[model samples]
Target: MFARRALRAAAPAFAAGAAACGATTAWLADEADAGMFVVRPGLSASEYKPLVVGGVRQHTDGTTRVRFVMEEPDLELGAVAAAHLMAKASIDGAEVAGRVAPVSPLTAKGYFELAAAAAGDSAMSKAISSLKTGDVVQFKGPVQGFQVGRNQFKSVGILARGDGIADALQVATKLLSDPRDDTEIRLVYSVRSADQIVLRNHIDALALLHPRFKALIVADEAAPQWTGPTGPLSKPLLASILPPPTEGDSTVILVAGDVDAASGKATKARAAGVLGAMQYSPAQVRSL
Candidate 1:
């Protein structure tokens, strides 16, 4: 996690990024102090910049939201959509790297989430996992995304495992404030057990307050009295919550967590006609 002063120093750089396009940024704040989740400008698509970890938020599943403060507070990140972020970290003596999506076309809540250990070995972000406060990470840019060409899908269906919720929770926060109440949003979240479910209050609030949002929470193994959707997290269960995407419906599926879990939803979505669904992995936070 980054220390607080980094945000104060980076604010000007963020302003410059927005200023380059004559666009004024709207910094949205809720649940935290003003400007805590500062939005920095997108970085140059060609180079890697070194940044220090200012702070970190740890989750029970071992995922983390890492906040980096620019070593050069005055440095400017070039532009948004002009480039996306690719992060690298030096863990032990080895180098690790991965692509990060454009969350808000800038920073994703001022910190990036690192996915936990995953199956198939992809999207694990080993370099990032070893980071602690004051650690340095390298960030480069100009990458691809999983969105539908800036068309914000009117409907969002989320399928995430416990390891992925750290970042998905942030996404859910934004959806709550969507101008379109008609935005159809749903979550199919699963964990190993009740103890594995973190941030229960916020999740409950999203379901209760959002007119069109619902959650089907399940546990793979639970006490006999536990009553919720049971999960191994499969395609059949997904079909039950979110129907196949129709030609005219503007829908996007969001997948996060381990590579296997995220891939399952992406694969299922593509097969169901949702060709270009928006995908998210903890390692690739601030994603499109």
Candidate 2:
């Protein structure tokens, strides 16, 4: 005991050591990032972290969604508002970014997702081409720019299309599961064709889960099985559902979809007086 006390007394008092130890101790799951994640625990903007491909889902639209699980079970890919991740398969490889899925972590717990093109010369396309189950891919981020002041909004709207709707759906689901006081959610999903309608089961479950929240689906051609609204997802249609958003960022509208759909819908939504149409792809994270 005397020798141990003498050693402790002789130990150098490195100020940074305490700070470093505090940093290490605060490495808990970032679910407590208020409403947005700016500082990640296991992930860094400058450091590249290796994640293994756990699975892949091939969508009918020639797009593929890859799922990567963190090496540690307790590790998490943070979420909400613009918190996102970027990944590269090999050194000097292409880079792809995606908002870590909400409600359900991509495919499984501790897993994150990235979207890749079927065929293209694009940087993201090239970067993810080699991804397969069990393969290692380097990840960067949890990068964020926008922050969400939860109580500031009177309501929230999500305009999404294609497979990208999955993320939006998850958000809606989370909102329903964990209702925000005095705030409402409006979710709209559009597909070019009825056959392209994926995740219908989850969508239906969410609709049933919270009847108060608006869930609208638009298809180019209405199929008999689809009991929801039909025709193109036009601003006129949305205008009927949601009053033109008032000024101020409080009226949050999350816009998700590919170039052909979301781009014009967002413009038209704004033209219809809808404000704060945040992009799910190009703006926050690129999975297209």
The Cα local distance difference test for each model comes to 0.51, 0.51
TM-score winner among the candidates? 2
Every model's TM-score:
0.56, 0.59
Per-residue C-alpha lDDT of model 2 across residues 1-288, encoded as one tens digit per residue: 000000111123443453454322122123323232122245556778887888877765455667777665645554444345655555345345533322244223366666645343244443554467877877776565234333446666676665446556655554454434345767777765565565566667666767657777777666776676777555567765542455335566666544233333322222222222422223322221
Clashes in model 2: which pairs?
A: none
RMSD of each: 9.0, 9.9
**Model 2 worst lDDT run, 10 consecutive residues:** 1-10
What is the number of residue pairs that collide in model 1? 10
lDDT (tens digit, per residue) of candidate 1 on 143-167:
5333322225666766666545544
Off by over 4 Å in 2: 1-40, 55-67, 90-109, 113-132, 145-149, 163-167, 220-231, 243-250, 257-288
TM-score of 1: 0.56
